[model samples]
Target: MGFGAMNLAPVYGRVEESEAADTLLAALDAGFTFVDTADIYGRGSSEDLIGRMLEKRRDEFVLATKFGGNQDSHGILIPGMGRPDYVRRALDASLSRLRADHVDLYYLHRLDPTTPIEETAGVLGELVEAGKIGGYGLSEVSPSTLRRAHAVHPVTALQTEYSPFQRAPEEELIPACAELGVTFVAYSPLGRGLLGGTVRTAADLEEGDWRRGNPRFQGGNLERNVSLADRVATLAAEQGVTTAQLVLAWVIDRGALPIPGTRKAANARANAAAGDLTLDASVFRRLEDIVPRDAAAGAQGNESYLANLDK
Candidate 1:
């Protein structure tokens, strides 16, 4: 398991700097050495927080941050974002905010449709050669894109949203990563808290929480999704574990590196502990039966969000 810093920012709701700092420190202390963040997460706010809070403990963690990505819009595939020159600048900017000489792993947050993936990989390879990044990865890209990018320069990881609610990656992405020796970084492995029963209704989220704007958290969709999650929750109870711990364990069992985000120290510790928890085949079978692949309701994301995925 790894740590996701997106929620450390006020992405889901208001989060104080002290709380965020504690969460980051706690996550590291709790054995989550792989920390993942993005430049666009809070538009640099998340990286800045990580930089300030964890700078002293830098050597203790493997830092990963992404660049050149934007969604929740037209999925325009900004030409400049993918250009070689901009990629260099983005790394420098990320490094500055991360307070690090080089990120252990850097990902292209959005696959640039306008530019050949090979070209982008070439620039990232240059960065690695120049000591700006240890390695480069791709996000929301197709298997073909991964192949093309890996051929140019060895791809380090492939970061995407994966969980029981979002199983599209199982079709091709997981197989390609396994074949190419790439890490399948699973973000939102807990179905963004829905599978954990953390979110029940739209009203369960804060007024400014971004999930409120998500189609999956809206009226009827929220009810249907919660019902599915409840079944999993019941099984989790019978197994004497929190719904979240069960979900996290299942994600690890699936051979993907799950990086779940939380703003609480207790939750961070619990998440890390879940990585070490063992699950039996019976539990896995029950989980699959309760929530099979593609068993989610509502739009996981909007048209713009889907456009950038598997591009």
Candidate 2:
């Protein structure tokens, strides 16, 4: 299992510095071997926090970081990665900020719609030749784009949002990855806490929180989604596990790595424990009916967010 440190570094919450360190320590102590961070996560604070926490035992874990998104840019995100010089500079800067000589996995966070994927991937392949990154990946790309990128270089993984609610990747991306022998790293496997039954209503989120305005968390959709989540909770209770565990079990059972994020130690342990929960084919079949392809009513996010999928 991998830990996502996007919200653990106090950008959206009041997480204390010591608490962040403790969270990382708890994950490490609990046997988490992989961690996912990004240069743009918390404007670089997430990497800094993980860097400080793992300074003494850096070799004990695999570190993954992303580039391609601007740290300070607001409003709608535009596709980037135009200049080869900028890509090289970004990798060097991320290494400097991480206080490490190389990254275990380096992902281009998103494909630059304006630039050719092969060109960007070619430069990334060059970085591997230079020994700056151990493995390379792409996030949120379509099957066509992935095949094009992989043709330029051997892509190690494809990071995307894949859960019960967001199953579009299954229609094409998963099969492509299987054919190409690339790992599918599933991010947001818990549906941003919705599938875990932690969020009941839009009112529960703090002001300015991204989820508060998300379509899936608004009005009737929130109610409907919560109702669906309750069913997952019911099944989890019958299985003597938490809803989080059931969700993670389903994810890993699909043969993709589930990278769920958490700022709390208990949640980390629970998520890690999900690795041992094996769902038989019968159970998976029942779950498919329970959380069908169109189980939820609302969209995963706003139109702009989906638009960035480059479909």
Candidate 3:
């Protein structure tokens, strides 16, 4: 389990100024050693926060951040950002923003359709040799791409949407990672907070919340999804664990390191405690029956966001 720093920024909604530091400290104090962030999150604000807040406790955690994808002035994704040259610049910039000499793990935020995986992996391998990063990984990429990149350089981790809410990875991606010895990092393990039992409807999200724009949180989809999650929440109640903890525990049972982001210290502690929650095989089977891979309604990301992701 790890702390995902994306929500520390304003991406989810309006966060208090001290929220980032509070969440970071809480996560560290709660026994989370891995923290994941992205350069694109809050347009570098997340990285900046991590750098500033963790400067004193840098050795306490394994820090991971990603690059390769960027947005234009209008927040439109700029394609072809994964070129070797761009990756060099991006890593340097990320290192600067992170106030660190090297990250424990660095990942390509998304694959560059225009740039071959082998070429991008080659540069990342060189960076590892140069000590710019401890290791390199890829995000939202296909199994074949993973193999190609791994042939060039071993991928430290593969971060993607993996949860009871999103299980497309189980079909092949997760198997491929296990086969190649790549660590599978599961982001949004709580279904982006739906499995946390807070988001009941679209209106539960504040104005400007990123999930508000996600198709899964809209209209009929949100209704159906929440209905399914509520069932799991009830099972959680029976199991004497919080909904988020149950979800995280299930994710762990599936052999993933889940990194769920949060904005509150209380939520951070609750999420971290999921690591210690022991569930038996019967509980896992019951949960699986409650919410299967295709149980969640709508897409994981919006069309625009999905366009850049590996299909």
TM-score for all models, in order of appearance: 0.96, 0.95, 0.97
Superposed by TM-score, candidate 2 places the C-alpha of residue 24 at a distance from the truth, in angstroms, of: 1.4
- State the lDDT at 9 in candidate 2: 58
Report how far off residue 270 is in candidate 3 (Å): 1.0
- Expressed as tens digits, the lDDT of each residue in 148-225 for candidate 2 is 988989999999998887788888999899999999999999988889777897767876566765788889988988
Instruction: Rank the candidate models, highest TM-score first.
Output: 3, 1, 2
Query: Over the stretch 1-311, how does candidate 3's per-residue lDDT look in tens digits?
Result: 89999998888889886977898899999999999999988889999988988888999999999998786655456877778889989988888998999999999988888888888999999999999899999999999899999999999999999998899999999999999999999999989888888898777899889888798999999999999998998999999999899989999999999999988999999989999988898998999999976998998878778887886
lDDT of 1 by residue, 123-156 (tens): 9999899887899999888999999999999999
Best-fitting candidate, scored by TM-score: 3
lDDT of 2: 0.82
Which numbered prediction scores highest in lDDT against the true structure? 3
lDDT of predicted model 1? 0.88
Alpha-carbon runs more than 4 Å astray in model 2: 10-12, 71-74
Local error of candidate 2 at residue 162 (angstroms): 0.8
Off by over 4 Å in 3: 73-76
What's the distance in Å from true for residue 229, model 3? 1.1
